[model samples]
Target: MKKSDVLEQIRKIGLVPVLRAESESQALALAGAIADGGVTCMEVTMTVPGALKVMARLAKERPEILLGAGTVLDAETAKECVGEGATFIVSPAFDEKTVSYCRAHEIAVLPGALTPTEVIRAWDAGADVVKIFPASAMGGAKYLKSLKAPLPNIEMIPTGGVSLATAHEFLDAGAYALGVGADLVDTKAIRGGHPETVTAHARKYMEIVKGFQAGCLI
Candidate 1:
């Protein structure tokens, strides 16, 4: 898919589930559960065992769903993930090299930043979108709103503290999309043989995003 289309789909969907699993099977299970609930995009973090294998399999098995590689720290890892069919690359922190690589390769890159300085630097460096990591620690939606005050043109994905309760608030605060972790992915639910639990969470989140988007429609 074109890089522009990938980003547009992300904003249209308005939810990016961040997946962290114990094993490849668990990751696949989580993806299936999320997809079943109407969410087709996810970030498979490098922390999971066999992360590359998981991405590869998902890319091949679930071609309809958009796949991204998360916790990508450097250019080399980003390149490998792209090779494995990651259309987008997400990182917990900004890496100049990684941003450059993505730009050169025509891939969407979301590099994480916290303060205004870091966020602007990443935006100026050509990040497709800036991810506000650990957003809850700095004040969640309020902080995101503050950042949007001056940087209204920058597209941002708030990566932490997003949940069924706060998802609407984050969108109201100008989040282009949300980067959700345990709240939506639910590793315990999947690992404990309760994939349905994760599916339920996905449905609720999808509802939240859908409602918010519907309200925004004019």
Candidate 2:
């Protein structure tokens, strides 16, 4: 998909399920479960043993879903995932090379940032979206609300501490999107053969996103 189109989809969904799994099968299965719950976008972290292949397989098999590579620390890994059909790339920290490579490839890149300086630097480096990671430790939604005053146009996605209960607060605080991991896709539940649990969690989160988009939660 075109870069703008992919970003628009993300903005509309407002929640990106970040998955860390024991195996590619688990990741893909969890992805499918989330998809079944109406969330078609996901970030498969490189922490997974074969993350590149996992992204490739999901992109190929779940053509309707948008797949991205996460924990992408460098340009080479970013390029590899894109070559393998990842529609987007995300990193825990901002890297100029990684941002540049994704821009060069016309893929969406969300490089993690914590401070105002890092956020602007990532934006200046051509990040499609800035991920405010470890967000809770940094003050979560309230902190993000403060950033919007001066950086109104910069789209910020706060990850690492978002949950179904707090999803609406982030959206109300002006998060362009949210990156949720364990809270949305519990690794233990998946490992214990409870894909349904993850699916149900996804459904609730999407409901909040939908409500926010419709201005029902404000």
Candidate 3:
């Protein structure tokens, strides 16, 4: 999908499941479970072994879902992920080279940034979204709200410390979306082969977001 369309989908969904799979089979299963729960945007972190292979498989098999590569740290990895069908790239820190690579490839990039300076720099470097790493450490929703007055156009996705309860808070605070990890997909559940727990959690979150949208319409 095009970058703009992917971004729009993410905005509408209000949450992106950040996943880490140990094997290709597990990765596909997790993707299926999340997709079934109404989450179409996923970020498969590169921290896991054989991440590239898993990403490639998901890209080929699930053409409808928007696949993103996360934990990308360098230019080479970013380029490789884009080639492997990553519609968007995310990093834990702001890297100019990685941002450049994504922009050159016409793929969306969300480089992690904490302070306003880093956020602005990432935007200047062409990051489609600036991820606020460890967002909870800086007051989470409150911190994001502080930036809206000055940088309303800078799309920010708050990762780390975002839970189902606080997901809506982030969006209401002007975050483009929430990047949910452990809280949404418990590692123990995945390792124990009970992906249904993750699916249930995803469904609950989706319901909360949908309710919030409904309230807005009312």
Score every model by TM-score: 0.99, 0.96, 0.93
**Once superposed on the true structure, which residue ranges of model 3 sit more than 4 Å away at CA?**
none
C-alpha displacement of 116 in model 1, angstroms? 0.3
Q: What number of backbone clashes does candidate 3 have, counting pairs of residues 3 or more apart or in separate chains?
A: 0
Quick one: best lDDT, which candidate? 1
Q: Give stretches of model 2 more than 4 Å off.
A: 216-218
Question: What would the TM-score be for candidate 1 when compared with the true structure?
Answer: 0.99
Write model 2 residue lDDT over 75-131, tens digit each, in one string: 999889888888889998999999988888888999999999999999999999999
Name the better of 1 and 2 by lDDT: 1
Cα shift from native, residue 140, model 1 (Å) = 0.4
- Colliding pairs, model 2: none
Model 1: per-residue Cα lDDT over 94-168, one tens digit each: 999999999999999999999999999999999999999989999999999999999999999998899989999
**Highest-TM-score candidate:** 1
Predicted candidate 1, C-alpha RMSD: 0.7
Q: Tens-digit lDDT track for model 3 on 78-190?
A: 88888888888999999889888878877889999999998899998899989998898999899988977699989999898789878888878877888998787566776
What is model 2's C-alpha RMSD? 1.4
